[model samples]
Structure formats: structure tokens, C-alpha cells
Target: MAAPAELQAALDLLRGLRERHGIDVVTTAQAARSAPAQAAALALRHLLPADLIWHIEGHEVLARLASGDVLVLGLDPSPRVNGRAVREGRLRRATIDEGSARAVFELAAALWSNPKFLPEIEPIGTLMPPPSDALAVPRGMEFVSAMARSDRPLPKVVDEVPTPGWLAPGLLGLAGPRRQAFERTVWNALRFLLLHELGHVCLGHLELGARKQRYRMIEELRIRDGAAPPKAGGLTDEARRALEIEADGFAAARLFGEAHERDASTGLQAGMLSATASALLGAALVPIIFHAMQVFSETPEPLSTHPPLWFRADAMMRAAMPGAGTGALLDAPLRHWAANDALQRPLAAAGHTHPLLGQWLGPVIDGGLDGPARRVLAEARFARDGLLRGRLRVQQQVVPSRGP
Candidate 1:
């Protein structure tokens, strides 16, 4: 379909900006071949209203793209792992870097290739109800065990693995059902990234951001004229953080909220995992991607625009599975992070074990929650109940549920 007038206008503006800045933007035809682009198309079909058209284009820049009333999302062709939604006048642009998609596949490959992390990565078969005969396949742990016992060398860490294009086969030497499972996990993670950006558009965040920009511009002009700036007025830091959380909630609900028992069987047959499994896997991988990208430190950044990665991951799990307790949802990611961190560090280094492994895994071994994990759960619960519940309810009333 041809782009809508407003969306095309926004694309033209983006085109001019890129040209003026000497940045090369990918052609639409080229972008359509990308995994992130394909994921955006599938997601938009379900998440967008029929009348609300959108377009995808790739860029060379590594920065997150912005969105507004117009819906022309951008994707970065580079391999850098990052995704975000920003504000552009009348344009709702959600940019996902190709690196982010590659990171998802790499993380899955790393976990699946390792014997220790197999159980954590492949909880679908064991944790969930068993699949029917037709959907049955070797569990990840089974495959890893076979590989370990065989002459084939186990898959290496991210640095050693020969990275393939997004969603390409032979990722870390995985194939067949195992490969499909990895691909599904990566695809769902991309969907979550896109959906988060769409959430900003759906929740009218572009409008709110535009209002703030206008206020800032007015205040700047007042200051330029030597007039005393009035009391500060615009989106506050707290509100910005709240919006990030709300967007996370929106994306989680849309991706995993409507999942049903049938999805396990049906999704497997269709080369997808159950929504619950997808949610858990995506949650585990997203933080890993963020850490790899150096987007933020493990510790909280008080002045940062987004919440801490752990906090965002916890918030997403809560939104996806509100009824479930804080046990595996948070523990799974912490475990995966610990394992990944261990593999990344020098083996001979003293005190090399991931701190989280000691803190989180020790408690899991003892059959209880740890102190820091408990504190994070408390904060996530408080935010969900106190800040997000009412806002989400109102947003749902205005935004249409995704299509079947």
C-alpha cells in the first residue's frame, strides 16, 4: 500500500533531515527484507486500526526513532542493540535497530548452547502443560545434552559465534525444532520492542510530548527576551518515567495478556511458542540486550529517561502475568543474566561468579526469595497498583484491542 499523506509527509521530513545530516537511509524495499521490518508488519496488522496505515524504513543512525500522529516507523540497519520510541510531530515512529534483533537470537543461542542454562531457557515443555503428539519435539535441554555427549563442540559465547542475519537458520549451529524455537523467541522479542513503541502512539504520548516541547520552546523564548521565566511547566521527570512504565505495561498486556491454553499447542505447530513462554523468554533477553548495548548501568540512573532495566523487566512480567507470584518471573531472568555474565567474564579471575548468581540462586536453592529480589518485587507491585492500574484502564477504554 502507498503511504498515507500524513505519514508520507513525515517520511519526507525525515528524509530531508537524514540528507541534510549526510546520513544514508535505507530504501523501503531493502527494509522490507529485514526481520525487524517483517516483525513490524505483522505487529501492525494486529495492533493498528484498519484505517491507520504505517510505513517502515531503515536508517544508518543508531539512535532510537521518534513517533507522533503520523505512523512511519524507522529501523536502523546497523547491528547495535537498541529500541525506543520518541516524539515527532504528527509521526509515530518506532525504530528498532537490526542489532537488537540479532542480539535476541544471539542470547537465545548462547543460553540454548550451554548445558547449565538450558533448563532456564527451555521451561516451556517442562513448566507448561505438555504438548500433543504432533507438536512434540526434543526439549532444549535434551538437544543440549545430546550435543554435549556428542563429538561436536558446544556453541560458543557471543564473541565466538558466527552471527547470521536476523532470523536466519544455523544460529550457533541450532537446527530443526530447536532452531524454530530459538527463532520464535527472537521474533517475539522483536514484537515486544515494536509493540512498546506502538504503545506510546496508542497511549497519546506523542501529543503529551508535543505539549511539553511547546512549553519548553515558549520558556526558551521568554529567557531569550530577558523576561523572567514563569514557573516550570511541562512533562516532569516523574511523569516521563511513569509514561515509560505505562508503555511497558501496554506492550506486555498486548503481547501476553490475551494468551490462552490453546496457544501452547497451536503456537508450537505454527512455529511460535505459547504467549507465556514467549513473555518469559523475551523478558529474559531484553535486559541482556540492554546490558550488552550499555544503554544503562545495572544500578538505577535517577536522571535517566527510562527506568532501570531490572525494574522494567519486573514491571513487564507483572503486567503479563498479574496473578502469578514473583518467583520464576524475576528469578528466570536473574538466573539467565547470572549465567551469561559468568560466561562473559574471564574464567581464571578470582571472585568471578556473578553476584546475582550468589544472591538470587542461593535463595532459589533454599526455596525462598532473596533480599534484593524481594525489594524489586515490592517496588513493581507498588508501581502497578498505585501508578499503572488506573491509567491502563483508562487507556484501554480509548485504544482498541488488537485484532485477531
Candidate 2:
């Protein structure tokens, strides 16, 4: 069956934008055959809000991009990792690089498939702090770091490293239930990435920026007209940080809503637990993805737009599982510890550890500590309230004025 005319036009607009951005947009027929595209199709079908439909020029277009509406470009060799959402007028489109998506899936497979990381008989316990010599570097850190940070093609990088048994043969080699489970993990991770971008669009971050810009122009005019100098009336650095955090919260809430709805409808305890676990895992990977792409720093920078990766991870957890105490919040930190330890084992056996791992592992591992966890929860609360107010102020300014 053919797509409606409006939906086809929306897809065409997305294709043009992908090409303009040099993303090597593929034909709709070709995209249908791509794995990443298929994953995206499943996400759009199951994850997107059913009630939401977009209208362009009085004709309805699908709210989210249908499977092949945008290009699924191959591995991005550039430093920029993860998917991006672009807006052209009322239309918003998102695209994910196959390379980054593959990297995330491979990481998940490396950890999940390995018995050492996730034992079948028992759950991994809380982790202790790294030893004093931890700074000396673990064994396989070098190879992992190179694979993560190198601009070289991902396949080439993987080939250069000694293939570990865990990740060997890559994601494709798995079969039966294991493959199904692996695909779910990848889709969960992709869902988080896709929704995070969608959060920016839905939350009106771009619109907020425009409002701030217009406010500044109006304020400047007032200042030049011999009126008292206008106070700061634009988005500040802190405000930008807040917007990023808000988007993370938005994504987390959407994930939680989906899980909750599924659980409610099915009324199956096992299915509910599995869905919840997958949602948490997806949220936890958001920070790891940033770190792997080399976009995240171990410590927060003074002028950085986004919060530290750890903080964002914490914020998402708090938002998704509201009212949960410190004990509940420990899920993410524990998962990080297990994943880090698992990945390290193979690398250490190979006599090298990733350099990037050492940088963030200390703080992330420490996140399991009661002191740090409490501090993060408190800080996240304060930040969330402040940002919400800032966003409200922007909305007020941009709202159309009512006639007197």
C-alpha cells in the first residue's frame, strides 16, 4: 500500500535535509533492507504516542518518521556520535549513524554474552572502590580506548584489535533466543537515543532558543531608546544546561510511561519486570554512549552546555523512578560497575585497558556510594525546579498576546 500524500511529502523533506547535511541519504527501497532502519521502524510502531499525528499544510503526516523516511547513514567516523534531531519549520526529523548504533550494540553484546560479567546463577553484588593502583591502567583499556576514540572506520578498528571471545563474530553470530535478546537490548538503547532527540523537539528547546533570541533583540531596542538598561533577558549558559537536562528527563519519562502501559495492559509480572529492566538499561547506556563517543568528560566543565554524563544518568534515574530512595537509584551504578568489570576482564587478559575507562570509572563506580548518591539526588531536585521555571518564563514570552 502507498503512503498518504502528506506523509510522502514529509519523507521527501527529511531526505532533502539529510542530503543537505551530507548524510548519504539512501533510497526508500534500500533503507527497507537495512537493519538499523528496521529497528527504527519497530520503535516508531511500538514506542511513539498513538494519539500524536502531525499536520503539514492541512494534510496529516505521521508524527514520527516512518521506517524509511530518513537516511540511516553508515558508521560516522567523526567525533560526533549518536543520533541527531533536526527541525525545518514544523517538521522534525531524526537520524542515527549505523556506526554508533553498532558500537552500542556490540558493547551490550560483549557484556551480556559473557558469563563473567552477568553470571546465570546469581546476580552481581555491589562493587568496591578500585584499588590504589587502579590509576595504573587495566589491561585492555588501550585497545578499547583506541576503538572508541579513533576516527578510523569502526570495522577497521575492531579488526586491528585482537578479537576477544566475548565480542567475537560481532552481533550477527548469535542465534536463537540469545540473538532475540541482543536485538531487544540494541532496540532499547536506540529507543533512548531516539526519544532523547524527540524530547528536544517536543519540549520546544529550539523554540525556546528562538524566544530567547527575540527577547534579547527587544531588550536591546529598549536599552537604545534611552530607557533604563534592560536586565538579562536571554538564555544563559546555565539555562542551556538546564534544557539538556530537561530533555533527558523527558526521554526518561516517556520510557517509563511505555513500560508502565505495557505492564498494565499485559498484567504479567515477568513481562513487567523484563520491560522495566530493559527501560533502566536503556537509560543507563545514555551516559556510556556519550563516554564511548568521547563527548563526555569525567568532570564537569564550567562552560559546557550539557551536565556531566554521570549527573545526567543520575537525573534520568530520578525522573523515571520518582520517589525511589537511594537504594533504588543504585541500579544504574551497579550495572555500570558490572559492565566495566566485564569489559575490563577480557582487555586485562589481553594486557591492555582502555584509557578512557579509567577517567570516568572512578566517579561512576563511586556513584554507588551512599554519600554521592544522596548528593546527586538532592542536586538534581534543585536543578530540575530551577530549569522548569526558566522554561516557563520562555514560554510566557513566546505565547501569542491576547487582544486587550
Candidate 3:
């Protein structure tokens, strides 16, 4: 099914569940105190659309929602808030380069076009980031804490901006004359995120009252009967699983639009330059292994959350051949998560109660969360002369040019 159509189906299911279960939902950036609410918020938020009213509340949250307003509970800032300010060296940089700007525009456009990505209903505003000097910039930072409200709302709720942490740094770091590679992948990630959030809001999965009330009622009934009561909906294992898969589908379709198959042939071309550059750098590291020990080696698990180190290498292999779809291109990094030792260990620790949860948590748990395409750009080297043809050749390994 079309991504938009599928998104609508998911929303319909959520709305139906809310009506049956009886709850008033809202979407917000607030942090919920209770573990259940936190999990619900996390899962529900992914299902909501970009535009929708989110009522953030803390004290008396469920009661407020039942009375009418949806209570959005914003989490307090991290306690480690070292109020101490540190000076950062000023570096004047372009707010956007041609390639990066184009990429952002495309991402926004895709989200706007896809119902699943943007959702049918949502709150007004765009998802952008706070300014910072962090190396990864907007991509990794929890930069999307605020939203921009729009006066006109109907078909679309949130006015999304693809200015998150990933786009800027990815664009800045790429080596090619044209930033075609970074643009495509960065836009894909942005679209995926926007649509996932929009799903929750549109679906009414974030509603209040009914969820808490049902939980209380279930417990009360169980006490009276001296037997377990049937489970109510909302935040159930099935619900969370459905929502995650829905978002993944939304992201996948958005990345590989309707005509993605037709355009699949170009995958190799997009990564040719990027692959070559990385291979050469890797080869260069081999020679200076001892001297460049620090540079050559990566810090072990917990420090790195990006997909496996070899992910890009695999992408390089796939991109060297023709007929790889956006899905295949994207899978290179996901495979890293699948292969992560940290994630496997956790599944064993948790007894794998939920397979879907394990899959979702793998990336974050194993520190395999890095975006492969974006990372390539983040590591791209800019030639001083900026030569059109003087770029280094990166194959499986970087080999020096044979001819003079």
C-alpha cells in the first residue's frame, strides 16, 4: 500500500482503540514520570502526526485529561545540569551549503507529501534544533525539543523543518563537489522521524484518562474476583509492536517513494565517490597503524552507538554494483545493529520477552545508532584545491593512482 494510505490505516486503528477504550490523547515533547507513561509516550509519539495539540502536564495528569485538556508532561532538564558555562571557540560557517539546503527541502517535501510521514492531523510548528558546537551537531543532540505552530491547519498540522542534528554536519563533512550522497540519506532520516511522530498524534494514541482508568479498573476487578481480569488496550505489547512496524513502514516507503524501484539503478553512482574516499583513508591507516594507533582504532562498546564500524564498508560493496534499492542501501547499517554483540547480550538478559522491542532497542542499546550515509559525509575530507578530478580513488581498498 502507499505510505500515506498505510499511515491512515494505522491512525484509524489507534483512533478506534481510543474510542473503544475511552481516552483523550495529546502529543507533546514533555517527559513522563512513570515508566509506563514514558514507554507509552515514546511509542505513541512515534505513531502521531506532526500537527496536533499536546497537553503537557505533571501533577494530576490523568484527571486533567479526563476533565478535558490533554496533559502533556514535559520532563525536567537532566539533573546533571552543570549550570556552569564553558567557552567554545567561534567558527564562522555557512548556515547551509547548496547541497545540504536542497536535502532539507526534499526531506520536508517528502514528509509534507506522505500522510504517514506528516500524518492527517497534528499540532502546528516545525521540528528544528538548538544551536550548538557539538561535533555531530543537530543530528545526535536532542535538538528537536521545540515546535513551530502554524495558523493554517487541516490537511497538515505541524510545519516540519528538516534542520535536525544530522543534516548540517553531514552536508558540511562530505567531500564530493556535489553533495548528492548526504542529501539523499539525510532527507530520508528526517522524513522517517517526522512521519513517525505524526502517526501518534493523528492516531489519538496519546489520549489520557482511559489508559489510566482502565488500568485501575482492571486491578480493582481482579481484587474483587480473586482472579486475573482481561487486559485493556493502550500500551499493550501488541499496540507498541504495531506502532513501531507502522513507523518503520512509513519511513521505508518515504525513503523509497512510489518510483524508487525505477530509480534503484543509481544507488552505485551515489556512493561511488564516498566509498572510494573511505577505502583510501582505511588503507592510509593501515600503513601508520602504530603511529596513528589512536586514529586507527575505535573505542570499544558503550562509547560508540553508531551501527557497526564495517557498515559503511558493506554499503561501499553494495553501492559498487547496480540495482540496489533504497531499502538495500539503508539495510547496510541496520545489519550492523542485527550483528551487534551488545544488543544480542541484552536480548539474552531480558529473556527476549518482546522480539520487536529487542529489534528497536538494539540500535540504541548496542550504540549502533549512527546513520551510515550521514557518517560517510561527517568523515568526508575536503581537498584544499577542491579539484573536480583530483579526488582520491577508493575501491575495496584505497590504491594510489597507477598512472602519472
Candidate 4:
């Protein structure tokens, strides 16, 4: 491990940059607060890169720091923050080894210098201290005053203690075969979130708002869309939202590159896998009558944010083994027979077929269908039902939405 003095020097340098760059950071320390919160803070600090500094307060650390620039250290939580202290046992015992710590610190440092690391969203100037600060801290208000010193005047990070009753879901519960699937989902989701945030910073949407009214409108829209609100001293919701979408697109393009359109194709392939697996599993499991119910229950509902599951399963099956002629038209009986077997078998009877589903749903057995296959299936069904097909040509009445 690097010497404490050396670490301190690195921290000093980062903080200096934050000050010079106009970035704001918040601090939290375990030695400054109750035992529980302190431990959690300590664990959090270690897990983070050394480029990030640990701010020592009384018993806890809850301040934010710039993820890429600025390290916030030293503060007394009792002065302004509210909440009971955390317990030591509840905190995970994992420590950042010297090597990993150095690696992370270096990563952060490199990111700081990289043009890619620049903020994608505009910073919203705001700050809030811990609840304890109001109770006994005369200088607790420094949280806001400190913002004045920043050159960028952006809230880079916010540090606050976790609530007393807070319980982070255990990773163990997500273990086993299901765990891998869950991790895939979580990984993609987290990556998406980070990308979106980066997009905001990179796109320069922060400067779009000029007043509280405009900012508030942006914030409301973001909330309605199910995004996490900006931290106490972070960027505005509008900036974050716009940036998040940008990041998602960036990540999608970067990860898939020239295969950007191929991702859709890939997703379709996964859907085929899901469909094949579902059909096989369904057939293996129970009575033929039960097959219809299982298929119906597992069927993807229309108008969902996600694509149809059956369609995805079918697409994946096609991708896995390509070059087959139109099986639907060639062997109608065979398709039904095959679907019967698929419907009987449980997805668990199969292995990691989630990836065959594509993107978020690719990791789990329970998810939406493939888009292409869903359309094809719908068309096939439509063709089979001539009456319904003819009805499609009739005019339909438009239903207006009720005012909210």
C-alpha cells in the first residue's frame, strides 16, 4: 500500500484541481461519527479509487466528491447531518488491496486527463450538509460556503451517510445459475446509467437552463421518466436526462461498433433462443392442455416498454442455427410438435439462454419477446385466421385519452 503521506499528497493534488477547475466535493469520515455509519463510510472509501480521498469527520463520512476530479476529505457529520450511525458488522469486510487501490487510483487519474472523462452534463450549483450539522455545528453551513471557492462551481460529488435502516440487498441471494443472469442485467443497466450520465456531461446540457423555473420543469420530466434525482450538489435533471440518453447511444455504438444494426439482429436471435427453449421446456414439463396456459401466461403483453418474449425466443433460435428455410410454411405440423416439447420443458432445464434474448432480457429466462419473431408470429397467426385478417380492413373508432 502507498504510504499515508503519499496518499495524502495525491489527495491534495486532486483537491487542488477541483478548486482550480471549479468542481465541488463533499466529505465523509468514519472516525467522525457513530460506529455503524463510520464503517460503511470506510468501506465505501476503500472500494473507491485512491484518487478519491476519504474525508474524516466525527463518526461517519457522507459527503460527495468528484468521481473524476476532486477529493473531499475531513468533516464533522454531527455538525449538520442527521441519522443514526451505522454498525460495523453490517458493512462488507472487503478491503481494497494495495494493488487494486493503486490500480483504481491510476484509472481515475488517467480518466481525469483523458478528454473522454470531461463532464457530459452541465453542473447544478447546490449543496446540503448532513442533518447533524444543523443540531450542533455552527460551521455546518460551510457546505454551501465552500462552493464559492470552486473554479467550476459544479457539485462533483456528494457524501452522505446511508440511512440507519438501510439494507443493501445481498449479492449471495443473486447467486447460483440465476446469479449470472442477474449480473448480466445489473451490469448492462449500470453501464447504461453511467453512459447516460456521461452523455449529459459530454453534451453540455447543463448550461441550457437559466433559472429555477426552467430547471424545475426539467427535473419534473426526468422524475416522470424514472430517473434518479441529482444529488444534493449535482447537475440538474434535464442535463442528466439528456446526457443519459447520449451515453446509452454512445455505449451501444461503442460496444457494438459497426454492428450497431446488428444488435437488433442479435436481439432477434436471442429471442429465437428464448422461444425455442420455452417451447422445448413447455413440452417437457406437463399436460398438453397446460401448454396453452403456460404459453399464454408467459406471452408478452403489447405496449410494454420491453419487446415481446416469444418473438425474441424465436429469433434467438434462428440465429443460433441459421440457413434453415421457412419452417412455418414447410412443416406446420412439425412446428407445432416442436413447440409442444418446448412448452413442456422448464427454462431452468436449459442453461444460460438469456443471452440469446438480447440486451437486458438476454440474461434471464423471464423477459420480453424478440421483435422480428413477434411480428412474424403475429403475421402467421393473422394469415391463419382469415376472418380476423379481413376484419383488419374495416375502419376502427378512435378512443381519446382522459385528462389526467
Best by lDDT: 2
- List the pairs of residues colliding in candidate 1: 66-86, 67-92, 67-93, 68-91, 68-92, 70-90, 70-92, 79-99
Candidate 4: Cα lDDT at 109:
22
Q: Which ranges in model 2 have alpha carbons more than 4 Å from their true place?
A: 1-16, 23-37, 49-80, 121-148, 151-179, 212-237, 261-273, 295-303, 319-404
List, residue by residue over 1-404, the lDDT tens digit for candidate 1: 44467555666766654465333444556556555445544544445454444444433222123433345455555433455454434434465655455555445554443333333333333222222324221222222222223344433221233333321322434545555666666666766777776666566655553453521111100111222222222443333445555566666666665453445445534443455655556654564345323312222333234455556554444444433323323223332222222122211110112333223223222323335555544444343333333432222232112211
The digit string of per-residue lDDT tens for model 4 on 152-245 reads: 4233222331221211222222233333332222232222222223333333323223222212111111111122333212332222222333
Q: State in Å the error of residue 257, model 4.
A: 4.4
Displacement of the residue 85 alpha carbon in candidate 1, Å: 2.3
> What would the TM-scores of all predictions be?
0.55, 0.58, 0.25, 0.25
* Candidate 2 local lDDT, 1-404, one digit each (tens): 23578567766775565466654533344335445445544564455455544432211124654533321212222222445555554455544544445455555565444334323312222212222335342321333344444544444222344434435444444554445545666677777776666666566555554542421111101111222212223444344555556566667767766765665677644312245455665566556655543432222322244556667654544444423223322123322223333223222321212344435444543345445545544444344344455543442343112211
- Cα misplacement distance, residue 131 of candidate 2 (Å): 20
lDDT of each: 0.43, 0.45, 0.27, 0.27
Residue 120 of model 1 has an lDDT of 34
- Give the winner by TM-score: 2
Q: How many backbone clashes can be found in candidate 1? A: 8
C-alpha positional error of residue 349 in candidate 4 after TM-score superposition, expressed in Å: 16
